[model samples]
Target chain A: MQQTLEQKPPVSPKVSAPPMAPTFSIPEPAQMPVSADYKTVGVPLVENAKFAMRDVNVFYGEKQAVFNVNLDIGENEVIAMIGPSGCGKSTFLRCLNRMNDTIDICRVTGSIQLDGEEIYASKMDVVPLRARVGMVFQKPNPFPKSIYENVAYGPKIHGLASRRVDLDEIVETSLRRAGLWEEVKDRLDAPGTGLSGGQQQRLCIARTIAVSPEVILMDEPCSALDPIATAKIEELIAELSQNYTIAIVTHSMQQAARVSHRTAYFHLGKLIEVNDTQKVFTTPDHALTEAYITGRFG
Target chain B: MESSVLLPVLALLCALAFVAGRSRSLAVAGVGGMRILNSLPFYYGSLTAFWCALPSLAVVLIWSIFDGVIIENMVHALVPPAAVEAAGGNIGLVMNQVRNLAAGHLSADSVEPAIAAAADRLVALERINRWALTGVALSFALIGAILAWLKINPQLRARAKVEDIFRWTLLACASLAILTTIGIVMSVLFESMRFFSKVPVTEFLFGLEWSPQTAIRADQQGSSGSFGAVPLFAGTLLIAGIALLVAVPTGLMVAIYLTEYASPRMRNLIKPVLEILAGIPTVVYGFFAALTVAPVIRDMGVNLGLDEWLTISSESALAAGLVMGVMIIPFVSSLSDDVITAVPRSLKDGALGLGSTRSEVVKLVVIPAALPGIVGSVLLAASRAIGETMIVVMAAGLAANLTANPFDSVTTVTVQIVTLLVGDQEFESAKTLAAFALGLVLFVVTLGLNYFALYIVRKYREQYE
Candidate 1:
């Protein structure tokens, strides 16, 4: 049996070679570890917590997408998850508001708590839970309505306001908070879809803020915008972070560094590192994180 | 040659042209290298084949369409003027007899000597005409083949020319449907004009009664038919309204269930079964409405303890309307399902992420986004209901009562048209021509409905990323 094991025709001969190559190899993806467990190489915990996720695993059908992601989101802080495309950053971010429940065949395990309550509990009604945790998508998706109606949609549905005057006030306040009140103040009756791309995104942000959610999740909100629009959104995010605890998933490391208080690095569905945004950029503890930031390879 | 033999012969020549064209191009390219050729060899082959077939086939088509008319005219000329004078200038009857004689279907003893002589001349003319057709068509094929073979060279833009011909062919096919529609509309317009010429336009448009009887003779009494179409219009509206009332809500809810609530497996099982309702022939639904639903409704009214004031007929607009609504449900539901599913998942996510329940998300977001498409579907179903004849004919009696009550029997425009046109009648009579006028009105109403529906869809179409 030992001789046969030794004589097994050198299966996967390329895997035994040295792992470093100066030139980028796009066709053959870099070999990643296949262990059942993942390692946390740097700071992956936080002190003052609004959302604490521990040992969480997500599966789509029979394939595991996220493995044992343990991270914490602090109150009034923006935590940005950055990695290459399909690195499970968006999947982990969606886990906070139970967004993955909408997808059939997606199974999530382990604990994810929001304000010390298990959000994934079967008894939990996602209606109020989602009201508390609003989200902005990668592309702007404003409701097909007037600008005022778009901002008023969330408040009207959740019964956040009773009188017309109060609903108007909420819409105004949400728009003001999203920093879109100045430009769109005169044309409240125009269709929201008629706005520019950046304005449409800000309109979506205002719509989310109208519901008064505690934590706002953004999934690559500025990736679809021009540089000037991205700058405006980044500035708006910075101001909004003072009031709401934010979790942002982005492909741009520079955007994450500019807007987030803490940055988390994900590689092959594992939580590689988490630290202050400045420290992660200056001195990343893991080689993969360093390699990604330096543009050596993803 | 006969048509069967000529077609195969032309096809054989075209095949030979294709081979010759390809080989010529290959030989020309042998010294200059294949790169000098303008297009691939297959395109040259196709160009030659198209050239060989198109002109020769056109000749055959023209000959086939006009040969009988031309030959009949020639044969008619051969029948002497004395024979025509004998038939009292009924040249059509005389020609029929001459044709029968030429075919030997008419016995020689029963015909006149002039007709027999004309029949022999007719036979000879037909035989000569066939030979001339075969000769002219073969020469045209030979000329076309030679021209195409002469034009085959490395410099020819064979691919582009072939593509242009293909584009024209596709355009012709597409225009066939439009031209046919134009033809139908023009025919209806001409006949309706004939109808309006006899009956005043004002009387037809605004008349309050619809008894369409006409006096056969000048002395006939109580046979002057009233041509008021108001009752038919009212009946159509009433039945269509009832159908809309029943179909819209049921279809919308079923669409919502299929798109939002039901699991994938349940959806797959239920969707096709719902569509099977659409596949059922309207005639089947007609009898079912007439035989089953009409009596059931009458019995239900009887069981309701109402007095003799409200009498339920065996055939009611209610019966026809209800089954038409059932028939149209699959139309509404299937179209609505497609548009509702077309509402981007991102919008649903946006609503759900705002903490709204599933019902709230669908009502507030998905429905609003899909409303324009849903209205279009409803209009389509409405036109179908308005145009439906079999159900109304079998279920509703043909009484032109201009009443608003659903329990009374009524007649719709479609039913009136079917009844008027079902049996053989003289086309010159106003009674027969009234069918064309009713058809024109029905066509215009449905056309207006479709235009309005399209306007709504265009004005409110939503954009989503």
Candidate 2:
């Protein structure tokens, strides 16, 4: 049998050579070894917590996206979630304000509390809840109205201001807090979409803060901007963190280190590590976190 | 040679030129020298083919279009002056005799001798013209193929030349529609000019009465019919206004419900059902308007105790306008739904994330963004409503009545035009010519509305991107 096997003709490759010059070969990547029994390694809980989530599992149709995540975000703190693409960081942040409820196929089962009040209660309305916790998206989305109207839209709809001057004051104050009043004050009646990319994001932030939310969620708000625009947004975030609790999702580790107080590393929909930002960057507690920050594999 | 055989030969020659050009380039470049070529081998082949085909096809087209006129003029020159003098210097009649005798449509025994000689000359010139066309077209095709095929080389910019040809081809295709539109406008203008010559423009424009009666003899009654068009214009505006009132609100609500409120599964099932209304023929809608809606409206008015002043006529503007509104619903809702759906998801989410309810987001954010596009759709629907004729002719009466009341019997411009030109009538009569004048007015109005709609839609497109 060994002689017959050795005498068999060599099998040809299934794919023929391309018609042009042959391409250079690249070696295949080695398979990464990720153990299944890993747990959350670093400090997942915090003191004076503003948001407390326990055993959160998110699913779309039958496919589970986030698996049993437990985390806490403290008051007046900025926490950054970092991971490779499609690791459920954005999915976890959307669950805070029940924004996932808009998607018909998405289902979330967990206990999420904001200021010790259940957000996913049977009778809870998303309107008032969203007012208390506003969000800034990856892309700058301004209403196709005047610049002043962009800032005044929320106040007008929520009836926060009783008089026209009061509404004017609210718009001015929000724009001032967002650091965009100086650049856009003269063009109050110009269309909001006519602003530059960075200015538009600042306008979006001002639009968000008009409602006085306690916590602000930002999903890679600087991803669409240039480096100079990104620096301005980072400066804005640092100043805004003093007044409100913030949660940010980022693909850049340097951005996480620069702006966040705490950093959480997620892998394959699992919460791998959470700790102080300096410690998470310098000396991570989990092997996967070390591999990610050290650029071994992503 | 017959053109049927000549055309196929020209096509085959172009194909051969493509192959010859490719082979010549390959032979000059050698195996490894293809890397040094300016463009791909396929571009060279296309260059050769275009050069061979386009000039040959142009020659054939020009020949086909003007060949008869040139041959007829040559045959007319061959006719004797005595033949023309015998026919009272009527050249048209003399030419007709020549063409008939040449085709054996007339007998030469009864015809004049000079006309028979002209007929023989006519037949000979036509046969010779056919031969010249075949010979000249073939020589041009062959010379073009040879020149293009011999010019193929490694360093030739065949790709750029081919792209230049493509640019002109695309320009020709794009201008075809514009040219056709200009042709239509010019024809309508000239006919309306003729109509205005017979009747004064002031009487047609400012006269309030509109009775166009054609009297064949001198002693007939109503010989000179009145041509006032104010009542027709008023009736058109009344019907169109009512149609807009019915269509704008209902179609907008349907679009808002579909885009903002309905689920995807429900949208899929309902959108096609709505578009089915658009697919129904206008003639079908006309009968439906006449048989069903008219009687119901008349009865409702009678039952409400309105017999003399407020009573709806059996053929009233309200019935026609209401049905026309229903007929144009798909145009409004479909276009409005597209613009509303085009409102970015980020804008809607931005509003909702700021504590605004779903309805508030739609009302404040979505509607304001899509407003210009909605107006464009409404204007387009207005044009459709104005140009509509069958339903008005069936459900609305022909008697032109000037009133703002929808219950009164009225006639629109399109209905009047249709009534004036339906049967066998004297094309030279003022009554028949009035139809062309009304057609010109209707054309101008609809064209202006369409142009405004396009401008608005373009402005909306710039707002987003």
Candidate 3:
């Protein structure tokens, strides 16, 4: 690659690079302890990492989107995926839940396992898999429905509650988990669209939580929100990490630093590096990861 | 021939003035000077043509209005006062005879010698009047041309003046449409008021007994023509109700299939074919209803053991309403397809991402978001059904029976209005005037439906935005 670059005529100084190094030491995996701070006790430890992705590659027709990406999502832990635009972080995140199957031209290969069972196996049903791995989108898109009905929709469809009290309890618990019960409990009959953007986003989160998924995937969940709303969502994500494995794709470096325990950096369709959040930010092994974190290149 | 010659002379002068003005400006600042002007050279040309044509056209219009009256007065003065009085209200008849006599054709009726001489005198007077009008029109054109030439200067602000004229012209075009609607309403109101004067307003509006025959003599008539509009109104509502029942669900389902399930190739193929149903003239629909659908309905009625009173006919409301529903399916489906497709894709993705199936997302999110627009489309289609004439005229019978049964023969307001005004009839009679009354009622109903639909659509838009 270095000889090829030296032979080609350079158009601009920005295109030039030093010769590729022959030997560089790949860092050993670090064992970081989970934080002890929490509002509640007796939360279960993330066991054997709930979801494990290995060498996943995604293609949209002939154009490759995600290339040889690997990720391990621990149960009850928040892992944030951060990258610049078109970096395939979202593509890799979508592959874990089989959401990419919804797109007509997208073809995802390689293995994604949930609890050591292959999720992408031909015999596995996609609907139940989706129920186990729910998603929240970038913008707040609450159903044009009443608040009570929006939260109760999934529970009703899955037959999660047999009696009226059970259904009510499910709605209340989900809303409480999302930290929206206090603001919306009095007017549960009001249309969900009538709420503020942040409240609507929380309502959507509660709606997803009502299904009792094992993992929650958020795709830039705070991108469309104001600072205060983003803060509220970050606090909710911290709370949710105690019960569900969470994978968040975000553009804000500071947000990833604040919310995630494990950080994965992607560049140009490749997972350049993944490490403990503090180490990834303070001392990255890969030159691309260092440049991305230090704001030198994206 | 002289007026045609004068018009072109005025046109030529205007064209010359435009070239002169443009060239003079170009000469002042060299060849590229036109780019400096605010408007193009053609605006200046049209401006010159407008000024030249306007005042002369106004004078010509005024002359044409008064010319006939002035000539008739002069001819009348030529005759003696006693003779003119004797001609009396037969003056128009006498004038026609005089014109024939002046052309050397003998009158069909016997002509008195005095009338023949008076006709001869009128021919001389017409010849003199024609010469005077031509001379006056020419002088008016000449004066207008001179004034336009003087005003066509470099600093005349011709572009601004032309734009103002165009602005007023557009306003006049717009007002013409508004004024025409007002004129139609006033005409309907006047005729309806006349019918009401003959038959009391309360009886015409709400009376149960609707026989409208006024006895010409002590013993002149059979059954009287009824003026009670309740039967027709009820028939219209029943038919429209049946149409809505068939169209609303079917159209919405078709819209969902097209927007949500069908591939792009299927959508492109099916949408135009469905819309073609709307373009197939209502008369053709009427024929299908009367010839095809009605017989099938009658056979079905027989199989159901319906009595003679309830037996369907070749001209039954059921057939017409069903075909009309089919005719209006495109109206509902196309509108709904647009509204459904207009729903943000993000909303669909958000629902689907939460582990919801395609059907679930459609039912819970897409349909609710598009509900108001769908309601608006249905209401508009309902208005179309109520106002339809040709379909009901050919398929639905002329018997104005007040019944909810679709199999029974019925007459709607549009059908009755068509039957009342088919051939030559005295417009002054209550029978003819009743058509206007029916038309007025139909207009009011459809207008109200349209306004309500617009209101719903606007309100829903406010909610989402």
lDDT (CA) per prediction: 0.89, 0.89, 0.80
Q: How do the residues B146-168 of candidate 3 rate in per-residue lDDT, one tens digit apiece?
A: 56555554555668888899899
Higher-ranked by TM-score: 1 or 3: 1
Candidate 1 shows a clash count of 0
By DockQ thresholds, what CAPRI class is model 1?
A: medium
Pairwise DockQ winner, candidates 2 and 3:
2
The positional error of residue A238 in candidate 1, measured at the CA in angstroms, is 1.9
Span of 10 residues, lowest total lDDT, candidate 3 chain A: A34-43
lDDT of 2 at B1: 73
Kindly list the per-residue Cα lDDT of model 1 for residues B1-465, writing each as its tens digit. 664578788889899888888887788778886688999988888888888889888987898799899888877777888788889988988898988988989986799988887888888888887787777887787788778778878899999999999999999999999999999999999999999999988899899999987777878885788899999999998998899889999999999999999999999999989979999999999999999999988777778744276757778889999999999999999999999999989889988888878999888999999999999999999999999999999998899999887888899999999998888788998999999999999999999999999998987774432
What number of backbone clashes does candidate 3 have, counting pairs of residues 3 or more apart or in separate chains? Answer: 2
Ranking by lDDT: 1, 2, 3
DockQ of each: 0.53, 0.52, 0.38
Model 1 stretches astray by more than 4 angstroms:
A1-35, A39-43, B27-30, B64-66, B80-88, B215-222, B305-307, B462-465
Report how closely model 3 matches the true complex, as a DockQ value: 0.38
- Model 1 chain A lDDT-worst window of ten: A25-34
Interface RMSD (one decimal) of model 1? 2.4
